[model samples]
Target: MTTNKLEQLKQMTVVVADTGDIDAIREFAPVDATTNPSLLFKAAQLPRYQSVVRGVVDWSKTQGGDINTQLINCSDRLAVDIGAEILKIIPGTISTEVDARASFDTQATLKKAYRLIELYEQSGISSDRILIKIASTWEGIRAAELLEREGIRCNLTLLFSLQQAMACADAGIYLISPFVGRILDWYKADTGRDHYPAAEDPGVVSVKEIFNYYKAHAYDTIVMGASFRNCEEIEQLAGCDRLTISPQLLEQLKQDNAPLIRKLDPARAEAATAKISLQENLFRWSLNENPMATEKLAEGIRNFAADQRKLETLLQQFWR
Candidate 1:
């Protein structure tokens, strides 16, 4: 079966790989790809990436920081290096994340993003090779705004509420990864249930809310629905601007013989009424007001940061 869904949805959306697995990415053939610290952490443990880890180790040694400190820095460095390598295989960009610890520090997030861009540039990749990943926090949006003004683009991740998205578009950032899977997870965790059907899923409603709001307002910010738990969700969002699926789901999609439906349309969006924007304070307050987003955002950051540390440990072992 051909993953030719992209052709059908050509006018409506872009397809993106949401995996660090190069083989599956090659199989599905998404033009662009995205990776978080968690995915990179898992990929770096494979023997094929052992040499990659060693390369980081050797590079880390030359840098003159303490061994563990050097290793941690090298893990971040390696994520960008590996992402850039994947760019050579795909036709479009690779996303490399900023440290999640910097999620609340606008200046620190900006600096880390710049450092990643510089790494890509030094490796012969241009600004277009990468999208700096940042949490969709108030500080993160502020950092993305700064990056946008400086010609550095960003992918706002860990997003849930409509508030985070409107602010990103207002700031003219490149993309927003409104997580579909995680949104479902939040509802499941709270209500102890699943929202699998498009019409029934409040999670689907959340992303649709974001997508329509962006399109109707003429915002150029790309909405890439991410972290999908199942192909049902993916099928429902087939005509979104982009959908970033894991390699496992991509394979499942290829195996399943079901026909895909186009769920969203700009023409349809054009007919819907628009929504108003919220200022920074209002957006922050609204996000904080949502119990699910507030708890999940903090939890997501901590989990991703822990994976970053584990990735660093793997690199140190590779060096030895």
Candidate 2:
């Protein structure tokens, strides 16, 4: 039997490819794949996807709308186009993110998510195979709640705190992607330390807490640890519902024949105490108090929004 870490991990949890590269998806063969504006922007630069990018730009030219509207529409189609390609490689689901600039606007986020689904459906992909990725802000959570009721699943991204995770579980979201690497990055920058064993890793600790909370409460919402910095972090959360790993780390896991163990277990979570309820005001305050979560959440949104702009610039060049 193959004993590579990636294969070993699949035994305990669903493995997700956190990228927009079709070649990488084909190579890793993850159960699912996730794409955000950043990944999409980087993928667009690849020569193989140039035609796909041009196709969206050409379609935008035929549409009746202002330049800005056309640009937004084209970018939306571009993201889904990339997702549709990725869906072909992965057997399970593809998480396409909504515009980060709309993170604070529930209605706009809902509409954008709906539009992405519509595009996927038009391509013959069922809504069941699509998970609309959104930021884990209060408004984003509310939008997810509405979308989930309408049969559209959601993957809440940019998650940083237990408050965000609990709120997502409360909303009955299909999945929540708690960023592991970013949390570690925050702590590393603040404390001026770099070395952290898996047990001592702040990122690993956050995901374990969220995973335990979800399993303890028996909430159906899946906890997928995202933005991992190393293989150790991935190995630490071996029994998580899912882990969205980058192509680089996926390759690392593919090569190493290290033994992987289940760090998180449902039975362990079953021993956890009662669940905690969070009101809107309390959720807001809790997030604000966690400086790391607050700063990282804002930074993440800004980075994604910037990537979206870069994508727009690339589209404008092709559109013109």
Q: Candidate 1 on 68-142: residue-level lDDT in tens?
A: 678767976798778977897899889899989899999999989988898888788999778999999999999
- lDDT by residue (1-320, candidate 2, tens digit) is 65899999999999999999999999989999999999999999999999998999888778778999999989999998888898877789999999999999999998898899988888888999999999999999999999999999999999999989989998889899999999999999999997788888998998898888888878999999999999999999999999999999999999999688889888878524368778899999999899999999999999999999999998898856
State the RMSD for candidate 1.
2.1
Which regions in candidate 2 have their CA more than 4 angstroms from the true location?
Answer: 270-273
Model 2: ten consecutive residues of lowest lDDT: 268-277
Q: What are the lDDT figures for the candidates, one per model? A: 0.82, 0.92
Q: What count of clashes does model 2 give?
A: 0
**Residue runs of model 1 more than 4 Å from their true location after superposition:** 1-12, 194-196, 270-274
Q: Against the true structure, what is each candidate's TM-score?
A: 0.94, 0.98
Q: Please give the RMSD to the true structure for each candidate, in Å.
A: 2.1, 1.1
Clashing pairs in 1: none
